[model samples]
Target: MLKFVKHNLETIAGVEIYPIISLSIFFTAFVLFTVWAMTYSKETLNTVSNLPLNDDESLTEKHNF
Candidate 1:
């Protein structure tokens, strides 16, 4: 089955560029996210980190299901 798919793909023109384009997009997004995370403010990070543990009534009311 794998061999059949590989043979079909090998017969197509311009098929090889798809993998290169996908890899480039993934690499670019990963780099951007890493940079953003590294530069994120510590104060904002602390507030976000504590959100789950916070017992504020307003949050629970606003998000009530």
Candidate 2:
């Protein structure tokens, strides 16, 4: 698979711009997604993975029980 992609990209562009373009796009998207997740994810890492809820409330409860 890699060989085929490399061969085609080199042949088409004379220097393999496809791989560079693909990597740039992937890194940009990954950074954007990480930023979005850190800023906007509803379930924070602290709350979801570390902190315990109060005794009066059950995590499965439909309301603030």
Candidate 3:
């Protein structure tokens, strides 16, 4: 089965670039997320991290969930 699929793909022109494009997209997203996480503000991180434990009811009400 794998050999058949490989043979079919090999017969198609420009089919090989799919894997390269996929890897490039994944790498770009991974790098962007890493940079965002590294540069994120300490205050915002603390606020979101504590959201589940915060006792103030106003936060929940504002979302209109």
Candidate 4:
């Protein structure tokens, strides 16, 4: 398997750079997505993360004591 991979690498002149190029592309996409999410995503999503409530509210009808 190692020999086969070595032979293939030799046959493809620029294949060694492919991994670097792909990683760069992936990083660029991730950054773009993060920026878009931060700047253009829903305000509800942004506020939801910092909601005032820290506990769950019961669904039952409110009772007056």
Candidate 5:
């Protein structure tokens, strides 16, 4: 089954570039996210990290409208 798929893809004109393009896209996104995460504020991180443990009332109070 794998051999059959590989043979079909090999017959295509631009099939080889697909993997390279996909890998580059994934790599770029990973790098951008890493940089963003590294520079993100500690206070915001704390708030987000504790979100699941926070009560609904607390959330409303903290972000009062």
Candidate 6:
């Protein structure tokens, strides 16, 4: 099954560039996200990190159906 797929891909023109383009896109996004995370605010990070454990009454009131 792998051999059949490889043979079919080899027959297609310009198919090789698809992998390079996809890899470039993934690498660019990964680097940008890494930079953003490195520079993110520490105070905001603390607030967001505690969101799940927060039990404020207003939050519960807003979400009540």
Note the Cα lDDT for every prediction shown. 0.87, 0.67, 0.87, 0.70, 0.86, 0.85
lDDT tens readout by residue for model 6, 1-65: 99999999999999999999999999999999999999999977776676689877675465451
Q: After superposition, how far is residue 45 of candidate 6 from its true place, in Å?
A: 0.2
Count clashing residue pairs in model 4: 0
Off by over 4 Å in 3: 58-65
lDDT, candidate 3, 1-65, per-residue tens = 99999999999999989999999999999999999999999977776777799898786576543
- CA RMSD for every model? 3.6, 5.5, 2.6, 8.2, 2.6, 4.0
| TM-scores of all candidate predictions against the true structure | 0.81, 0.45, 0.82, 0.50, 0.78, 0.80
The best candidate by TM-score is 3
Candidate 4 lands at a TM-score of: 0.50
Writing each residue's lDDT as its tens digit, candidate 5 over 3-55 gives: 99989998999788989999999999999999999999998788777777877
Q: Which ten residues in a row have the lowest lDDT in candidate 6?
A: 56-65
Better of 2 and 4 by TM-score: 4
Considering lDDT, which of the candidate structures 2 and 4 is the better prediction for this target?
A: 4
Which runs in model 2 stand beyond 4 Å of their true positions?
1-15, 41-65
Candidate 3 structure lDDT: 0.87
- Mark the 10 consecutive residues where model 2 has the least summed lDDT: 56-65
How many clashes show up in model 1? 0
User: What is the lDDT for 61 in model 3?
Assistant: 75
Report the Cα lDDT for candidate 6.
0.85
Q: Candidate 1 — worst ten consecutive residues by lDDT sum?
A: 56-65
Score residue 26 of candidate 3 by CA lDDT. Answer: 100
